[model samples]
Target: MKNQLEITLQNRKNLHAILEQTPNEDLLKIPQGFRNNIWWNIAHVVVTQQILVYKLSGLQMRVPEALVDKFKKGTVPDGTATDAEMKMVADFLLSTITWTKEDYEAGLFKNFNEYTTSAKVTLRNVQDAADFNLFHEGIHLGSIFAIRKML
Candidate 1:
């Protein structure tokens, strides 16, 4: 899944530039029918990776616990994300994936605690989680795109 992972990450980076170009007002605007804003969706994708991969494997995640709690599944955007926060998200977007790749190469993920996603897909190991993360990110990207249209 290495090549596929790279492609997904690249796709995210490309999409992220479009998101970054969004006006802060638009990025943070949660349309009446939507559960989250563009910023929340983007940050959720990043936070989800940490949860599905690192947290499930019992390893320390790169992102802070507060961030994970704020953007993880079932959470909604409580308020607007500032420009500074969005910039941080943009900077970390690719960096987190690159670090995950490097860490995977270093064999840091020795054990994976199996997990079942809300979609009912069960992931039993690190590679499984990694592959699942691509799908998860894709879903959010689709959401982001839709939210962009609403904005």
Candidate 2:
């Protein structure tokens, strides 16, 4: 069994490969409801990594403030992202994952608060949070894949 951090890192790598194969124009189409495109999903994962890991661990989010509202959680895609902006976000996300992996492996977030929502599982530590975040990534990845198939 792989550790939580390893699993999370693997998932991030997989997502990056998926995005690399996905074209820029495919990132703006909405296949379903108010859900954003692949670009939004990718950005959300990166942003949430900063929020849930760095912030919870008493570290600052390295991402710029100007990009926060555009990629923050609950900010749906309105077909507003340009090719350059999408590339920027993608590069930032990849770099953030590289930085976050070391922190996670160091066990710096061992004492953070545990959150138990109405969801199917309970996260009690950084391990749980890492695992759950990977699951969250899967949800968004699936959504993106479905949307891409539709388009």
* Residue 33 miss distance in model 1 (angstroms): 1.3
lDDT of 1 by residue, 51-141 (tens): 9989999999998788899899999898677667777778778888888888988989999898999999999998889888888888988
TM-score for candidate 2, residues paired by index: 0.79
State how far residue 111 of model 2 sits from its true place (Å): 4.1
Task: Kindly give the stretch of ten consecutive residues in candidate 1 with the minimal lDDT sum.
Answer: 79-88
The best candidate by TM-score is 1
Instruction: Specify the highest-lDDT model's number.
Output: 1
Provide the lDDT at 49 for model 1: 89
As for candidate 1, its clashing pairs are none
Model 1: lDDT of residue 16: 77
- How does model 1 score by TM-score? 0.94
Query: What is the total number of backbone clashes in candidate 2?
Result: 0
| Tens digit per residue, CA lDDT, model 2, 1-151 | 1365566667777777767887677767777663677778887887776766666556767787667777777677778677777677768756776677766566665566656634667766666666777778778778777877788
RMSD of each: 1.2, 2.7
Worst 10-residue lDDT window, candidate 2 = 1-10
